[model samples]
Target chain A: MRQNSHGPIGVFDSGVGGLTVLKSLMAHLPHESTVYLGDTARVPYGTKSGEVVTRYSLKNAEFLLEQGVKLLVVACNTASAVALPALEAALPIPVVGVIAPGARAALARTRGGGVGVIGTPGTIRSGAYQRALEAADAKVRVKSRACPLFVPLAEEGWTTGDVPLLTAREYLAEFAREGVDTLVLGCTHYPLLKGVIAEVVGPKVALVDSAEATAQAVAALLTERGGLASAGHAAPTHAYYVTDVPERFVEVGARFLGRPIPAAEQVDLTF
Target chain B: MRQNSHGPIGVFDSGVGGLTVLKSLMAHLPHESTVYLGDTARVPYGTKSGEVVTRYSLKNAEFLLEQGVKLLVVACNTASAVALPALEAALPIPVVGVIAPGARAALARTRGGGVGVIGTPGTIRSGAYQRALEAADAKVRVKSRACPLFVPLAEEGWTTGDVPLLTAREYLAEFAREGVDTLVLGCTHYPLLKGVIAEVVGPKVALVDSAEATAQAVAALLTERGGLASAGHAAPTHAYYVTDVPERFVEVGARFLGRPIPAAEQVDLTF
Candidate 1:
């Protein structure tokens, strides 16, 4: 049961939001194959309790591990916030969660100013990003807000115009007032609303995309461990699995992944 | 075992939104004891597939039925839309869903003008309301739109104000332009946004509250079947259950139920 470099990288999200991370991973490490599991049957872990999210995350990770993945990626922010420790302990493979990478990027980007983290209720409530930022630097000031509507807006493709603009302003006005120089896009879906978020927070605040940071971190970890897939393999295959019907995942997932998903195999995590 | 006349009515929703329907049911049927089950672990069935929703609804119904209830109420609009037939066929007790009653009320209220129905994507996509409305009268015109943000907005307590007003205007403008004289507040959570919706749609268009309609429907069905709980039964105990932690449910559920939910016991639906 030794970890092999040829095995696919495992990535999971509560739902399609994690596709952003998968997309980044694909771009960052072209030679690595990937197996993605979208826990569609019980999605939006953002509003659920820590125990419930952890249980669900464990199931998702187990399913991904069965696919012979070398490393596990907790792509969902809510899971990354609440279940990362559990995953790290339970999984034999190395686990990369989006929170730490995003936090590190935010800390590095901030210029002696505070940092703001925006995400779902559960993620913000967990204070994972806040803790990560503060843990990295004792003097780092962190402010957090829960933007529950952003996921729905992004899925509905309402990222632009008045509705999103007003929503972004309402959620980020305090961050702007607090003079935060870097705002971490704590949730994967938030990257889609980058323009509106940037517009609301103004020019000074640097936006850290968790997807990009996590992908880079993953690449670095694999490179250092000598687990990177060799480049001579047939164009790295990407396989998708979901706990529910594949239609919605393929449709909305395209928005997050920035490409077409022809099909996704149906999976049942009940076992 | 036979469904007893004095037994509590069983109600289930994906989450707290159906508390609105429960609120009306409590008001309209004061003598009836009730057991409400919120599927908080996998909440927001709005955007999920029909098969997944029906499966969840069935599990929810089974849990409620085990509570020894006389009647079943599909309080969630998405569940009511897609799972009514299966629920009605599988359960021994009579099942009441919000869609049929709301459609009937809309049919009665509309004065030669078209009817507009607004709800979650799953409910709208199922075309349940449109089918029900048109089935009653072949000549009646119906239009349905999914307002995905409304649920999150309601949960966030952003029921009124410029953002919701603008969102309302954006969603309702088409109905206004198309001259729909009546709009059916198809989703249980939408009753919370009545003020903003009313203002946006104007005075001429009467908005039908499905919760009120559904409550009356349940009352009539129970009365007809001689299943109404007798008045002497310990002030009609109202028990609440959820699949996840009760904190968020109790907090946001108060808004939907129009009062307090002192506590909600957690239950596992994994089997």
Candidate 2:
């Protein structure tokens, strides 16, 4: 199928967590413009059922597609785990989900001591990363846990200090005992708590940040599809849309996005 | 207007957090049957905008109204703070919200050392309790803080741990410094962490659980409106409904409700 290489890459997550992926994309694919949608009204899809996640994911993808995006990126771990197959089949554009790329990165970095995966309950329960890793190497062992508090801890700006450290230890201490040399941060929000997580699991444990890996995957896919925007093209622009008021999104989203969100328009996803 | 006292009381919340309120209702008003709708698909209204919260609350109320409810209970603190007025105006039946009852309880118990209101960011930002307190007693001083992590901690079953203790201290220490004699647990989920919160605030400061206060308020309103269910009515039936899947709600809700939720019907609020 013919594609317009200049069309912006579209990214959507349950909420502002996807901005982390957008941040990496800006660094990895500088010439490609992007549109990001945060379904803040129904944020935190990590805890919802597969059917509900899929429905919301489809609506989010539809909204992005209407923007004439050349590619679709599911930046949310839970949605990627539960809705990727549905999205891949439904969207006309090439679809990239964080699970496969992050799994690949973990397998490549592990010292053959097994791999640990940490994410929201839905993502872990779906066994997306575990499946992806095992599919590549059947004998590879994977230990996984659902760290539900990490998202709230990250959003609350308690990334450091005793509270987060204790929370991290509570959730991740087992990985060290399990002898997993590599840990995949399956959720976008987990990247914000990387410091505490790293401290808990120790320095020897290689941490796989899905945002960076997903960006690399998108970059490679665009190159292969001849969908990479021309380097000579004008500087890329970023646009944000949200299903709720933009004030809180603008305020809290900066922490996740690594920069202030200049502006975001409110949208109704019912359409 | 003629009313059927046998009609069940309708309660709605953003998610399982409201189950705490329902627990209080079951204890305080044994004869009053209830139908609860938890908007789990769009849970955590605490972080969303007023417009979005109000819209969701209306949909929830409409769903309950269709269930033949004679009274409405806004069981979620964020919704109570942001959507109570809209609910009261839009619904024909009496609408009871947690904020006013909690504020009244705080004022009644304060030993003239002021009152501290703690809740979600949206609830704290709305200043609903502060306005209610001052409106009732203009000379009463009120301090409020947004304890964003409390809800997640409560749901994650970390209510008794070092993490929650530290978090509660972090958010509530200022109340002691401000000489507040009463601390209102303004969020419904807060009742679950009452032990740690009370420890942080100390024995001198009184902690008012909004679940109990709201239950009392609901009971009083029903009595005044002559809408109380008959004492001889069959064992009060409790029905649960959620916008998302029932499994997580049933599991997490049991903790909040203080008993297992036998079943919860999955629903779509779009109608």
Candidate 3:
């Protein structure tokens, strides 16, 4: 791969959720540098309207493009749901989102076309996953629930315990009743509550982490285009930017990244 | 009271949480009109730094002031905790916040000096309530815990149930261990979880709803200052402004206010 292939992969999320996707990218493709932008000043885009989300997503993408990235990743499920098409059309770089990969993964795993997808309100309301899955397989039956509390639960590091388990049960009970054999963790934060989700979802259902699927998609895309970073590339840089407090980003984000985020910095992305 | 004294009371919250306070204000002082601003564009001030929160609060206050409000209410717990002093120092209008009213209510209820406060990270970290309690009575002991997930639970409308009770227990276990006689629901959102919180805190701890106290304070202050709207004010106006997404605000905020929010509009606050 050329030096151009070694350029950083740019990822933007409403907040720390993208760090999970970034971690997966780093683990799977160690040679590729990455730049992440967390719009913490306006975090939880999941609750906002589609128009506001699209606007923020555009600004976030522009900020990352300004940094000279090889690829753009909409690591936020809400942004991916509402703003993916616009982002892809606006940027010259390949734009990857979690929804399609996740939908595909859920389709592959479901015995019954009955797939239950859970995500933030904006993502579920946007119906991106439902549309993506149905487009791939017209016969597929998709049901989605908006689990808005899961983000706060995940960020609070209450991954396990009765709180998360009960929350999971409250959200997943309808899915169980609907006989969904596959459940897509549509929101980036949902993966943190995986154990609780699995237990509540029971043994019959397969829980798909969108982060893992998205990572595989990124790797496949880069490899197919001969855009994979060379192994000879020196220790790849991983930089992080947040629109608000860097301290809280580093603190809450450490749990999401599964590593201390020492490279996180505060940046104003007014674009 | 003069015509100027009858102007609407200005209230500003980061988002819908303040609608809880606004609800109480309306019920307590049915004649008094209100002008509310929910800074939805930059919601979740709890995660942002003191400087950023202070700046937003100032902008929100100025925006409310421009509407010709008689008094200013910092309806957001995060803003009240971190920006109240700055707002009071800068604004000529009487600035009321949840912190002092909540602290007073807690002190009035505590048989012993031990008091437990549960709120967002910003409110807890600001230590405004702790300082307020101690300042009022030097011997009053205050212990605060950041129940960051509570806001999401409240907004998700999952207040009563096994999940909230379990979550409350997890958060307030330390307070129970400390044997706090009084528990203050410091955050505006916390009032929604009063049932679960009371269950977790038990019979010994009195749960003080800050919204109620703040409303009471507002009523008293207005009465003393001769700023109460007249009985014949003829259907006093209740105006609402949001920095972004008026549709979502009215949708999510109805439950918070326990009333349909029909007067909301969007406005840009550049400051």
Candidate 4:
């Protein structure tokens, strides 16, 4: 009944944005095979209701579980905020979400206890990061804002353009006013706009890349479970599945992953 | 069976964005009732494939037809661009889409032969506006740009901020360089950013709002079909439906509709 060291790690996002998490996973655990599912057919789950996102997250997890994964990563912040608990309770494999790891990292980075969290409206409204950070250290004050424009900016490949920078300044002005010492890149897409975000927040504030934090948590969990991929294993494989093709998912995904994705299998999952 | 003159007109969009079109319809045909469907579960048709958009659009039409509507409006611009033909062919009722009306208005407004069209990536890439303009007048040159950021800016209620003005300038500078005398607001959300867009593009360019144009088209079509609600009919009633509930569709929808949405019925449609 136990998961073996050889099974691939399962990761899923609403769309290619979660490639940020997969990139970090590849960096930290190159020996492990990963299977990623992007629900490109119905993306931007961040804008949907908790029930809808939960239903989708469960279905995505089910598809990966069917593929025999050793662990599961809900790489989307909105799903992590609203659906992580349900996924953890349902899935047999160890489940990791981006929220807790990012919260832990932000809590560790902030010297003055003031921490800022930026994400989608759904994620921010769920109060997942604030709850997680407060649960970690009640003394840490969490100031959260939803920079809804970042998703479209990242998708447009305008991360460094004046528009994104101006948008970041507009979204982050409140956090700067509050003098938060640390900020969590709560959504995967935010990492792509890190330059603008960092500049807007200034060098004094530590920017925590939740995707990187998630990878670290995933690594530690695999090691604890004795499910880490053994060294000398055949070259690790990264497989992608999306609900919609002809979407240039492979093209946009390449930008997010920082490498070419030759192809991704088109998939349809029923919830 | 013939559809009754009293039945509500059906309208569907990828999501709440269609409310803008519905609002225009309310003003243009005050005696006619409306049934609006927002496919919130699978929104942002702006990024999906032509075939997929067509399939979803057909399903949306079928659901509306089942409710006994007199006419159908494809309020989503991406749907109008990619799926309008199929919808027009399949639906028995008179079908109207937002594209042709917007294109016609732009063609009429342009004196310099240079027309600029701005929409979502899917709408722009479909070349629907360009082809529509060229079909009407052979010599009218068309320039199209995908202002992806405008959707988010409008939704975030940042339609007038410095960020939106800067983003508009960034997106519209090319149109200025090309000396476009007429610009079509090819997507429903773009109309909300009219102030910023107008300032960026200057006074010489005429802005055509697709929602308003579509409303006019629907009015003319209903009259041609003799399906217009009889004069002296009671004040119009508008009903709303969405695939995802608690999505703040009602709240965000108010901005798009320019009036509060009292409620929306959550629905699940089978394609």
When sorted by TM-score, best at the front, the candidate numbers are: 1, 2, 4, 3
Cα miss at B45, model 1 (Å)? 0.7
Model 4 chain A scores worst on lDDT over the 10 consecutive residues at A262-271
Model 2 lDDT per residue over A1-271, tens place: 6568989999999888989899999999989999999999888888788999999999999999999999999999999999999998998889999999999999999989999999999999999988999999999999999999999888788899999999999998899777789999999998889899999999999999889889999998888878899988778888999998888889889988888889999999943
- Candidate 2 residue pairs in clash (backbone atoms < 3 Å): none
How many pairs of residues collide in each model?
0, 0, 0, 0
Tens-digit lDDT track of model 3 for A1-271: 3325867999999999988999898888888999999998778899888878888898888889889998998999999999998898898889999899988988889997499999998999999999999999999988889998888888778888888888888888998887889999988898888899989878899998778788999999998888988887688888999988688889889988999988678877642
What class would a CAPRI assessor give candidate 4's docking?
medium
Model 2 is docked with a DockQ of: 0.74
Question: Ranking by lDDT, best first?
Answer: 1, 2, 4, 3
Q: Write the per-residue lDDT of candidate 3 for residues B124-237, one digit (tens) a residue.
A: 888898899999999988898988888878877888878888888889999988899999888888878888888887887888878888999998988887778889857888
Among these predictions, the greatest DockQ belongs to 1
DockQ of all predictions against the true structure, Cα-based: 0.76, 0.74, 0.56, 0.65
Better of 1 and 4 by TM-score: 1
* Fraction of native A-B contacts kept, per candidate: 0.79, 0.84, 0.72, 0.84
Off by over 4 Å in 3: A1-6, A223-226, A231-235, B1-3, B27-31, B223-235
Per residue, candidate 1 scores C-alpha lDDT tens digits across B171-234 of 8889888888999998888988999998988899999978888999988887777777878766
lDDT of 4 by residue, B111-192 (tens): 9659999999889999999999989998888899998888878877888878889889889999887789999999888888
Give the TM-scores of the predictions, in the order they appear.
0.97, 0.97, 0.92, 0.95
Which of candidates 2 and 4 reaches a greater lDDT?
A: 2
**What is the lDDT of every predicted structure here?**
0.91, 0.90, 0.87, 0.88
